[model samples]
Target: MSNRGAGGLLGRRPPEEETGLPKDEIFDLMSNHRRRYTIHHCKQADGPVSLSDLAEQVAAWEKDKSISELGSAERKTVYTSLQQTHLPRLERAGIVTYENGEVELTNQTERLDIYLDIVPENSIPWGVYYLGLSFLSCLVVVGLWMDVLPTGAVPTLVYPTIIIAAFTVSAAYHALANRRYRFENLDEPL
Candidate 1:
């Protein structure tokens, strides 16, 4: 017999190819709170979970009340959020399959490993980076206006230019610091 090795038939290919789920789709699937929780619960569950059961669990966790006790208003809100926002996205991602009244984790053993690795606990905030850049830019502009440095020694614009260069260096450092941890969905491999 040819040695297929440890993965058997399932682990033969890299995890990405085996799942047929794209990296972006997987990231989107796990980004949200409810969907993430649902996947986590399903992973631990013994078998397929019905929609009602899943809803009941979510409702209890979110509202601290039974699904039945939720009034029409609350029910409408939850139903809309689930049907419109959560289920469609999860279904499309191939992480969860919806059938009849139940949703089941499809090919759980094959996909779980990929899902865990792709979805990280934290992400670099692009907003923070841009904001810092803006703040530094502003500081440099003010320094130039104030004539804080010796004139003719360096052009007025040169001060800001040096600051800009420093900012670029720091930004590059930040990007590199978090580069390994970046989600594959957000950035292409360098």
Candidate 2:
């Protein structure tokens, strides 16, 4: 592992192989809501964005409104927060560079994305979902063993095979969805 930061009781910082982040720092930077929104907007933009534009977008996201529909207060609230707090935090973390009233993503910005995820309120985590699928697979296998489930037309292992295949496909789909927030692919279609 790369020792990019001084090691202590906390252990060596995580290597920068892909995420360009120490594992601990990623969480710290992502802890605030505004910073998360700042990085999200930076990734979504096609190029460097003015501070005012970024704040407007973030305010729009928070209000679930279009830019033109946003009240001055809404935009100003986000703008002040970003200018005085969030942008500086992100810059210090090397996730973005804000200068002269404009902000742009750095290579580290892409890595920051790994720390942010938006999940629906009603949804179980993917790991739990996969575990549930595995449990169902095992139950099917046991049902076959006990002959409680009819395996008359197909092989005894067929039901379990289908269940495992379903899990594999679902996991792959979710993996791709996780990458949907990546900076490099932001301009690409989902």
- Count clashing residue pairs in model 1: 0
Which number leads on TM-score? 2
Local distance difference test, candidate 2: 0.76
User: Candidate 1's residue-wise lDDT over 1-190, tens digit each?
Assistant: 6546565564476455667665676666667767865665566568898776776656555676766786666655655677677877778767788778677787743465545534335754657867877887787677667876576777677776777787788778766755444432232211
Q: Which stretches of candidate 1 lie over 4 Å from their true place?
A: 1-15, 64-72, 108-110, 117-190
lDDT, candidate 2, 86-173, per-residue tens: 8888888787898999999898765555455555458778889888888888888888879999878877777867987898899888
How badly does each model clash, as a count of residue pairs?
A: 0, 0
Looking at candidate 1, what is the lDDT of residue 75?
55
All-Cα superposition RMSD per candidate = 12.6, 5.6
List pairs with backbone clashes in candidate 1.
none
Identify the leading candidate in terms of lDDT.
2
RMSD (Cα, Å) of model 2: 5.6
